[model samples]
Target: MKRILPQPLMSLCLWLGWLLLAQSLAPGDLLLGAVLALALPLWTVRFWTEPARIRRPHLLLPYLAVLLWDITLANLIVARLILGPVRCLRPAFIRVPLDLDSDLAIVVLAHTLSLTPGTVSIHLSPDRRVLLIHALDVEDQADLVARIKQRYEQPLKEIFAC
Candidate 1:
């Protein structure tokens, strides 16, 4: 069973995604979707270096809601900053210490920072202890670091339990 269905969730997603993409539920489409769903997972399972597992899966929804809210607010703030005087912008790179240990958790944090409006993840320390992020306008580095840890890292630590 493990060999036949290496990643059942992925297969199911692929199946559903195929149906939605094709916008059809006809017999032939269903058959094709099923075949692709089954085959794709089997063919690509070897490339998955790490198994996708969320330690605190129940926290995912709330975490996502918070992230989305932050993203929206960040967008508005960035727009306001961009419209203001160019000289007022203070771009700086700040190093955020990592608390989450898992590679997946680290990846999520980096992606989250990059997704936000005024910040971009520039580099992660080779030791995986710190992430360097570039911010468009930062008044205080310490405060920004504190906020990132509080708003993003804390939730990710809970969500992935890493």
Candidate 2:
């Protein structure tokens, strides 16, 4: 029943993850993995009262490709700014408003933004509405905000927001 069992996918992942991690299969290990897998999802259920529903799986490939490219570009830009002859950096704050409402999706977006070099997700407003991102260099606020909204938020919205 839903009362005891949690997300089925989580349980399956728990089982496989433990198997791969432990590298040996014993009865005790199997039982422990199963128990942990089930328990974790049950505990995490509160975090997502409603399950995440990704609408377009195909879009993920292109999204990931772009993110990877951005990572490389960002790393280069940051390195140049730091190690070059002079730091002709343009640092500034940009507020990115969210169209994706789900907590999981928003957290992923925040983390992804933070992970990219030269940029950091500084804060998300208490209402979980707008994200404050610190860019190591910036040419224009409008372009940056528009880029974030268009490049990341739009695809994420299509994928996770329906």
Candidate 3:
């Protein structure tokens, strides 16, 4: 079973995605989706170095809820900033220390930060110990660093802890 569907969830998503893209539930599409779902994971499995394993999987829902809420709030704040005076803008780049040992978790954290309103994940240090983030506006750099650590990094550490 494992060999047949190396990533079962990915397979299911591929099937659903194929159907959605095709915009039809015809028998041929179903067959093609099933084949692609089975084949893609098998072909690409070799490229994956390590499989992801969530430490406290139960916290995933709460984490997602918090992320969604933050994203929404960020959108509003960014919109306001954009519409307001340009002179008040205080854009800066800050380095955020990484506690996540897993590459996958670190990548997810970076992506999440990028998805939020005024912040963008600039780069990760070569040692992978720190992530560089650029913020569009900031009154206090320390506060921004602290919030990123507390709100996003800490949760990711817990979620991806080994």
- Quick one: best lDDT, which candidate? 1
Better of 2 and 3 by lDDT: 3
lDDT of 2: 0.85
User: Could you arrange the candidates by lDDT from highest to lowest?
Assistant: 1, 3, 2
Consecutive 10-residue window with the lowest summed lDDT within model 3:
48-57
User: Against the correct fold, how does model 3 do in TM-score?
Assistant: 0.83
Error of model 2, residue 156, in angstroms: 0.6
lDDT of the structure predicted as candidate 1: 0.90
lDDT of 2 by residue, 6-121 (tens): 57766787889998898879998899998998899888888876775666778888999999999999899788888888856889988998888887678878988998998899
In candidate 1, residue 56 scores what lDDT?
86
Q: Which sections of candidate 2 miss by over 4 Å?
A: 1-5, 8-39
lDDT of 3 by residue, 1-162 (tens): 899988886788799999999999999999999999999999999987777567787877887898999999999999888886676789999998887889888988999999999999999999999999999998999999899888888888888883
State the lDDT at 57 in candidate 2.
70
The alpha-carbon root-mean-square deviation between model 3 and the true structure, to one decimal in Å, is 2.6
The C-alpha TM-scores of every prediction are 0.79, 0.76, 0.83
TM-score ranking from best candidate downward? 3, 1, 2
Model 1 spans with C-alpha error above 4 angstroms: 9-43
TM-score of 1: 0.79
Greater-lDDT candidate between 1 and 2: 1
